[model samples]
Target: MGDFVLSGNVTRRENKLIPHWKGPHRVVVTNNGWTYDVQEFVAPFAIITRHIMRLKIFRDKYLGVTEDLWEYATYANGGHMVQRFLDCKMKFDTHQWEVLVQWRGLDEAENSWEPARILLEDFPLLLARWVRTDAKAEGMRSFVLNETSSRRGK
Candidate 1:
């Protein structure tokens, strides 16, 4: 088997509005009909088997498109590249909140989800924005609900 990238699922955190095409993982084994065992280098280097439907052939075009993705890959490959942060958000997850980031020189299509601790340490301003946006959204939602209830009572 060769190195292949894993496709992201639509339900992944911060991926709801974006395409999920993450990976370049090394293939550990190949199964029947486009399935392969792959390795994820994040954190503790976990191995996962994925179907060919979710895998793509790694290409050079995928690189240099976004700084965060490229830098993370470089680091994972034992290279050093300075990462620049552009924007951040706190996204609600099933169990907890997560940090979604927008990297410099990359559009909305390139923004990816990160851990909240990384935002706190590297980009506090984005964290503040996330808080403000959350508050504004909550306020608007409350106002709408109140108006609807009042109309129903009339």
Candidate 2:
């Protein structure tokens, strides 16, 4: 696993933490050139972008009128075909699908060459746990941020 220095807070949209981030956070660029941000992010936030490639497929297959199919396929196929389609064609943005395609290829190449794993045996409590921060306890109404704090009480 790569080193992940505590970058900072991740913002949320619609009760979920956003995945795509800007600027220099903390990412290890793999040999293939696709970088993996080592910081711990809210689970399943990455899942949202899973269908980004599917959107490309749907756009290519069905044309622009129904990019929604990419999303629909995610539910229907149980998101199984996401990576397959992504590998075949990476489309983070249907408008500029080539960039996405290149990125996905780099990521794939890196992962295949040298895979990363959560070393549970090495660090028993490495996994992050969710914190119910939505409740400001004073935001006119309580709202928990979709984020995780270190299990260590600090």
Candidate 3:
């Protein structure tokens, strides 16, 4: 029941510059009418947002062209595009690395913990950039970077 579609229902202040659509919500249900239940993807993989919108509403969205700074577009092969790697921490129970993934169009507080293994496999370049910036930004030890480099060699 998961498919992406924009929703034109989020409220906003009256402004001539505002975009009409609010989401690339995942479809959750097919109600009896012309409406559908959609949800925004939130962090922790547990929270839910409910917004049911009709198929049209002055047809909200961009001009069908993706901009570089815009958020949450999938890769050509269909997966979330990694906007940035914001932070990292070792999971105490799993004993593995989890990188904080900054999804486009979302706040830092909404970023989710993504497995380093998946990021390494999927978006190595973004992971590398984060490694360099994070180490410099916070004076983190290079042990993690070194570990990453070793993984990259394979």
TM-score to native of every candidate shown: 0.38, 0.16, 0.42
The candidate that wins on TM-score is: 3
TM-score of 2: 0.16
Q: Residue 135, candidate 2: how far off, in angstroms?
A: 55
Candidate 3 vs. true structure, TM-score: 0.42
Tens digits of per-residue lDDT for model 3, 35-58:
566655433222244444433332
Candidate 3, 150: how far from true, in Å?
A: 4.0
lDDT of each: 0.51, 0.24, 0.54
Give per-model CA RMSD. Answer: 16.9, 22.2, 11.3
lDDT of 2: 0.24
Q: Would you list the rank order by TM-score, best first?
A: 3, 1, 2
Model 2 lowest lDDT segment of ten: 122-131
lDDT at residue 35 of model 1 (Cα atoms): 73
How many clashes show up in model 1?
Answer: 3
Error of 2 at 78 (Å): 1.5
Model 3, 37: alpha-carbon shift in Å?
A: 38
